[model samples]
Target: MQATLTVSELLKRKNFEHCEVVAGKEGLERRIKWIHIVEVPKVEHLLKGEELILSTGVGWKENEEAFSSLLQQLITRNVAGLCIEIGSYTKSIPSSIINLANKHKFPLILFHQEVPFVEITQDVHTFMINAHYEILARLETYSRELQELLLATHDLSDLLSHFHQYLQETVVLRLKESTTHIFPPFQQNNSKQWSIIHKSIIDDTYTESKKISKKIQVLGKEYGELYVVVKNRRFTEENMLALDRTALAISQHFLRNLYIEEKKKRCENEWLREWIRGEVSLPNIFHKLGKIDGLHNYEGGGVFLCRKQEGVMWEGASFSYAKLLLTTLFEQCGFLLCITEYRQNILFVFVNKRQKQTWRDRFTQSLERFKKSEAYEKHAKLFSFISVGSFVDRLDEMEKSYKTAQITADICSEQVSSSETLFFHDDLHIYRILSLISDQRALHEVIFEYLNPILQYDKTYNGKLFDTLKTYLACSGSKKETAEHLFVVRQTLYHRLAKLEQLLGEDFMEPRKRMALEFMILAYEQIFIKKKEEKFPQCSEIEG
Candidate 1:
């Protein structure tokens, strides 16, 4: 609180009982900073603002116009009040001067009993100084209490509870766009009251309950708000400062705790990567996992490799969103795990505690619900390719499971007509083996060898022989159907087939050779075509 003495309070002091308010009764609440005694006609130089001017009518005995002008001057200077001692120099104040005081709401006091000015100033100044000291002492005690609380506990709820007790007022701490945590958590009966206050805070309005709120911000980010509800209570300037300091303490605590959480997440990410990479030995993997919170238990779970749909329009926020979404789903779906982002995919290593089928169904439902959620509506076209690895009880076998999951996800990405997004590693074992073989240069060479001559001929002659061969294979070696599909005459189709037989051997259409050609064409379309499109342009010629 700021130190001050109101006009009414000043008049209630000892030896000032004879003072009477002549005009401007409405200004009784006006605070008096100092007292001034002026007797001269020109009193501007002797007066300061918020001073109670004391005088004996000396220079203006019968000049009401000059008295009114003096009153107007005092009003302009923002003088607290005017106290005139009567019967010595002047008998009474004029009605015109009283009317001027009334109009301005300036306090006009009359000392009916001629008091000693020196004694009055001494008494009032001493009282004001003593009151100011008391306020400072109270402020110091309150501040020290808050500082001790800050040192005693890191829990924000406990700090807020103590603050409420100290102030004897309700204290609410709200993280912006988050739930409100109250000191004495709102009672069932107080729901309406809480709703009103919440609306007021969100709408940037005020309620009947006097409140002093400050934004809890640090490093240019506003974390939340700290507001004290001063219902039926008086809050002072000192209390406002106390609230500010307390909010600052909470902000620092949140920031410090946030750093620890980030460090923990980074460590978890690294450990999981190393586990999947087989860098950690079977015996040491569990020990390393013990270093991370909530992951110290025995190993028995499956791995999930999640990849977003190709060409999905999403920003970096999608990564965090996916992590948060999956983490929430895992926890609620009863398969607790840690999530890590590798490249563009998010991996989750679930700690197997229940039936695998049940967990799978739960995870699928959670993902479906997430896709339909408002939070994910902006990414409406976004879908995920999640592949689950086989359950393994041993830490050493986890890496093998993780590899299977990764391969399965890649196979799923290449699928064009799969109705389901979630794939099991066991169900796609053939494709997994095929994907491995598809990565070999020898296999690509064999596939490209059979198709390269036809490609070159088509490019050189601008002919449709490759299309004719593809269509003939697609029709399962029916020449009439191939001719009808190619919109060519039967004789022309026979002539093209003879030319093909001349280029390739007569045994090229054998079952084994045809099977190899079909496999080669599928490999060429899936592997080589995609690579050609993605490869950077070679510097074969200099640019102008």
Candidate 2:
């Protein structure tokens, strides 16, 4: 708050025909820190000497030059204002002065009531102090209300309503972030939503954007995004920040709640998994747990591994959102499967008479697309990897199938992108280990040896012979096929194959070596891998 001068009040009470406000605050406090005074009415005569001046209109009474000169002098004078005393000489204020004041946003005041100049000066000086006090009070009150909202509620909608009620702006949130717009199912193909909303944001075509429009950004590492905008017709920057704080606060609480719920659900799910597969026969298959469709039908299934990134999902997305997203993912994957949460992970089992290779491929593709779509984020954020178990024939072996899918998915996670589909045994060793090992630790140790051999080879030789061996094995011991696949001439391929065989001291065609090699790959995934995985892990056959 600066020095204030109320012309009407000052004139009515006392006389301070002192300095007139020519272009600044009238009844407002003025902080004209360094000021001056001038009475000249000529452009050349008056110079840039910051101050306020008192005038009687003698120099610019009627002529146009006089009128223009007086106005120009004020501008040139660089004074705060032209406080004019109206009495015998100057009867009424000039129209040009009024016009100029309004044009330049120059503060000006006319004194109609006769009063001494000295007394008016004293009143302006006093009013400035009170104005400063009032401003401080408003700021403090605003801060308190904002703080209250942060601690009060968990529900964003309710919190927003509270803001609308108390905060006074017509606050509303834009759920589908401008960056990512997910239209209702049927209307997605409709481009109208883009023109009406999306394009506007991209171009900042928010020409119609109100004086204050606030936005909350929702981004993705791979998939579609979701933004929540809280709009108000009368919104101001201050009020918008308050709303942003409230929205952010509520979102955080919701996420924290969900994080806890997800853990519990995963725990419950694993218990159910153990029981369903008969790994832990705490009770009968039907014990307390309700039957899930296709539950009994799955003789064998796969596990999908995923990670929902921090702050990527809805602010309020709790375990409920996680569960819902999983169900939707599998559903869209074309499986009528049962899903369970297992500690920071979501697992799904797909069971139907041996699903067609093509259908499995398609299902995996759909999941990949969905993960990359607006429905979920990608790369542990929303969309993740999936590993399917090899088909099993006996119901008694269901537990084996479950563990295989889980471990295979984990192995697949290290080698492929979360956007990948199925993890076949050939691609990831964990699948083989999950297939072979009855005990987890033995599986881990064997894998450690296999990976270590390759690790030492890579670190020591800067060589790629191990990869060559893996590829040859993948081709099923056919020299021609392996050579063709590796894109080397037959003789060159033969030399490399011979060198590999010599190093390992075995024939590439021997069943024993092939089996050991395959099992080792599986063992490596289950035991040696650093991070374990959930059920569904994107295991795309494509490299990139």
Candidate 3:
């Protein structure tokens, strides 16, 4: 069917004695596309390198400079190796030429046997053409498979399972595995694979394969790699080339599927979030989701809001597919959750905690598992953090909990931005203070009332003291920091604090009152901005 040609295979041909392979570096091989043969030196003008260029030396006279010119020209053209036919006229491959080839590390060949040059030309070209054909055929097949994958209505897991079956091959998606599951096959070989196959690939090219190592592409982007380890390790240059093309096709398919899945999730996420916004009752939320199988007997429950920073958290996972992914990640105790709101944000559905003795512990444990799952890490950066607020078990608690989730998630998102992320609500002291500002009306009242004296002071005297207090509170009440930030001396800052205490008839350093006042100021900073937006929606400066 198809011919296989390797560096070692090509060398085994008879009549090609004294044929030496030089410059077999990975750097050299990548630049080569295919080998070629032409009798005319004029062929050099039309040549692209990495080709095996041949000549009979019929037109050349016996000048040393002329011999070296052809050699130099071949090097400049970047031909992989040169095959020169030696005859009575040439009189045993020139010693000077031999020295030059050795010096340049150019592969030089001399044919002493009575072998037809046409035979070598025909065999090599025929093999390459066949390889091109086989590669193209496989690509066509994979292209069709990609089309089917996009058209299918199944979720990510089903699509992947079906894809593997269609190809009659195993496919693996290697995420950064946790201690729980073994890193599956096709994850990645150790670093040795990089050094071993590098010799065959020319550039940071799209895709290529040598033996089991295949670089797979998806929509011209290399998202993953594939390996097809068979019984034979005898992969040649041509063998690898064909497989490279195949890998490109398959990888393209996967990338396309991933894109489509993301788009579908976005549409579904919008619908789901809209559904969550309107959710008042536990069963009502599930009914709107059209996934209410487990909600019949389920009591009220808690809600968690998880947002991905920029893109979908689970690259290929969807809300509909959460059934399978969450099943593994969580205890499958939750049902009908959706990724709603901004980037890959997730909202959960669980049996509402009816018992006062057990308040949100199991739900929190399940959330802890979800945060540490393979899916979350895959798309962690898209959202700065996925936060769980106080779970609301009652209908009235849902509204406050929803707002608390938004606040806690914002704080959680900002905390573990780079190295590590936290899921459990461990820092209760800070979170509790922040949670106090979750009520919209109460938050609004605190902001306006605390700032009332300051706002009045600013309006009456154009005083910088009130603004300084506001800025300091906004910056989380750091003193040396506040004075430097406000362009005031530390003593001036103390004087202003004294004025504020006298004006309000309250102690500025009292632990209880200061904590309340500080939270009120923080609430003002948080919610006042929203009110300003609602007040001036069309103002470009205020909109963001």
Candidate 4:
């Protein structure tokens, strides 16, 4: 250990035999703060506490009673000791002064022989200053070691263990409700039980305790706290400062983890998007799946998608609320491997198959529970559609499943009703096929070709031909049923039919010809007409 002079040690120095302790023998081990030589009578102002005062008897020369009072003042001012030379102005030690020193246990040293106060001050002060510097140097060394740990260590637990080694005390890091202990490894055999108790202790610990504590706040965000539990003396300022530096190191570690996780999430999200778009081939997808830990282990699974209703205002608070609710709902299904992403108004959930028998039931129950939950109630007005793709056995088919789920979600979004919002791609195969046809411009033109002439004739003549033709086909060629449905007399319908026959051809209503016209009419209504009506101005139809 580094050396420093104490009161007892200073007394043992050579040429210090002239110095005899008159009182306060119990305080012999008090560390000497500094050596001061003062001849002034009133020296309280000139002395900082903990100093060893060296003086001649000039202050106590005239009155011995006044010297007794000086001893009390020195004790009150909390000095180390008063060392007086006896050969100077006053010869003998005063009895009253010695009695006062003994009463207060204040150290009063008597120098029988002439002593050089200046030389003693020089040696003692030099030693004291050097000791102070030693402490600072040790603290600096600790700080550098901790900084090196921050640079070299990748794991928080490792850094925490090092902090334990340095502090030589139980260090606990409380983050949110999680507690990390330093003395015992975090994964100790008894760690679980200890963690419960230790966490409670940390929570219940006195907030104002003298124990070292520093909140692990960095980059304007407060992560948690770093604190030491020492049963011995209160932490010195050096200890507290050490804890502060360690807290900063922990903060940097946390920030590094956050940045790495964010980058990983972005890369994973982009890869998933590419897979959903079917840009990744089967071979490449299988290769990627091999790299995933549990891809081949899944038994059965599908894609899950959810979104806020279109036109529902996307506010920050509501978006966060929706994201959290959806995440919680899917994450509770333990065996289902899932990765989620939120973009625009949609939350995409990609789930891997699981061997559990109740997986389907659990997923269904979770959905029902979410619907009735407070989270759902808070944003129910913004509820849109929930779509699940067809489950496939192999992992390679997940990309197709995601695409199917997305398509169903889009279709369900447009047809809002009081009906169930959940859609399954397996039940909508026909609609999926219709989606393909709906995307083709040429299909729109070919399907609507037969109706174009009739539409033009009605537009030019203000006739009800188009309406009559629709009702006629809907009635399955029953003229009376068509007239009844259109609220028109049979004679008027026949006249409209004659007009339609004249415009196109008499064979337009023949069996094979009628079948072709009927298919065209259905395709036009399902694909083209509905789209045009939505965009163009409405025209009068036959009254029904």
TM-score of 3: 0.41
Sorting all predicted structures by TM-score, with the top scorer first, yields: 1, 4, 3, 2
The Cα local distance difference test for each model comes to 0.72, 0.51, 0.53, 0.68
The parts of candidate 3 lying over 4 Å away from their true place are 1-303, 306-346, 349-387, 390-455, 473-480, 487-520, 523-544
Candidates 2 and 3 compared by TM-score, better number: 3
Winner of 2 and 3 under lDDT: 3
Better of 1 and 3 by lDDT: 1
lDDT of 2: 0.51
TM-score (all chains, Cα) for each model: 0.44, 0.35, 0.41, 0.42
Cα error, residue 251 of model 1, in Å, equals: 2.9
Number of colliding residue pairs in model 3: 14
Predicted candidate 1 versus true structure: per-residue lDDT over 1-544, tens digit per residue = 3556788888898767888898999998787888777876777766678888878877666678778778878888888898888877768878878888899899998888878988988887887788778877876786677667767777778778867776777788888779687766767688787776676456555656667798887433577899887665556656786787778778767655654454577667877888787788866866665664346555377688767557876455454454445555555666666777676766778775456557667766767767765546666554445688877777667787788788777666675355676688777744555666876766655755677666766678866777888789989999889999999999888877776777666777899988777777666655655466653122231121
Top-down lDDT ranking: 1, 4, 3, 2
Predicted candidate 2 versus true structure: per-residue lDDT over 1-544, tens digit per residue: 3234323343334454443544444422222322233345555453444444555556665455675667666655544555655665566666776777666655565555555545544455456566656645654564466557545755455555555554553344455533332222226666764454554445454654333334443221112222222333333334545555654544554445545655565566656567446576423433433244423333334444444446655234443554545554555555544566555555565543335454557556656655565345423454444565554444335566566666676556665664565575445544553645635554444544544555566558855676677778888878888878888888877777666666666564579867887766545544444335522121231112
Error of 1 at 499 (Å): 74
Which 10-residue window in model 1 sums to the lowest lDDT?
535-544
| After superposition, candidate 1 runs with Cα above 4 Å error | 33-51, 57-80, 87-90, 182-186, 195-209, 231-235, 262-544
Could you give candidate 4's per-residue lDDT for residues 273-379 as a string of tens digits? 67666577766765665574335455656677766556666455454544445545654554333344556535454444455465667677667867876667766
